[model samples]
Target: MRIEIVEGDITVRPVDAIVNAANSSLLGGGGVDGAIHRAAGPELLEACRELRATKLPDGLAVGAAVATPGFLLPAKWVIHTVGPNRHAGQTNPALLASCFTESLRIADGLGARSVAFPAVSAGVYGWDARKVAQLGIEAVRAYAGRPLEGEKPMVELVEFVLFSEETAGIFRQALEESGGGPG
Candidate 1:
């Protein structure tokens, strides 16, 4: 497995799957969620609607992940995971860590060789950027160290597609501290 740090919009990444830092409703809101929803068009919303209508009627739970087609986006699939909101008293780092791990698990299940992830809770969710970076790198490296659910994980690349250079710098620092350089 390879780890990378890049500052860019998550929606335009051409990876096999992209992780969406969605709210529990999975219906779409702000930040990465809104951008992904907008870029993927109405079909994406319909898919999410179908998911809500059937499987996730009460909305997705925090740290859990689910998949929907990327629709008009470049990625083949979108893995939606809810991050722990620190302001809402969901301050446990374990829940934040789960977002990365579960998203990877879902990605692996979908046969995704390459995945792009945003800083799951660093923005509007009120988590510190450094904390989000550390947990993200730690979870992804741990995921890489383990065997896949089926065959060995097809995940050749895991890219932290950050929204800005400062955030990317934070992730890069974490990756390096974990003995991984930008790839």
Candidate 2:
């Protein structure tokens, strides 16, 4: 698998799927969730509504993920995962790591070759940027290292797409430290 860090908008990344750091409601809130919802258009919201009305009536659990079609965005699918809120007294690192792990698992199930992820829980959620980057890159690297039925990983490329240069740099450094930096 190829892991890279790019400083840009996650909405426009031409990947098969992009991970949204969504709230548990999946109804679209501030930060990356709102941006993805707006870019994916009303259909995305409808999809989330459908999920809530059916499979996820009680809303998505933190660290778990669900996928919706990317209606008006460059990507084909959007993988929504709720990150653990640090300020809410949810400071478990495993929860943060699960965000990346679960998203990749969902993307793999969707037969996605590439995925873009934001700095989940880094902003507003009150998680430290460096810790988020470290945990995220570590989780993705561990996931990529695991072999599937074909002895190869399903997700070929994982891009840490951050809107802020500082966050992007942090992820870049983390990727390098993990020995999974851009090829």
TM values, all candidates: 0.96, 0.96
Per-residue C-alpha lDDT of model 2 across residues 1-183, encoded as one tens digit per residue: 788899999999999999999999999998899999998999999999999999999999999999999999999999999999989999999999999999998999999999999999988999999999999988988887774554566899999999988888888788778775573
State how far residue 61 of model 1 sits from its true place (Å): 0.5
Clash statistics: count for each candidate: 0, 0
- Which pairs of residues collide in model 1? none
Pick out the ten consecutive residues of candidate 2 with the lowest summed lDDT: 144-153
Candidate 2 versus the native: TM-score? Answer: 0.96
How does each model score on lDDT?
A: 0.92, 0.91
Candidate 2 Cα errors over 4 Å, as ranges: 147-151
Worst 10 residues of 1 by lDDT: 145-154
Candidate with maximal lDDT: 1
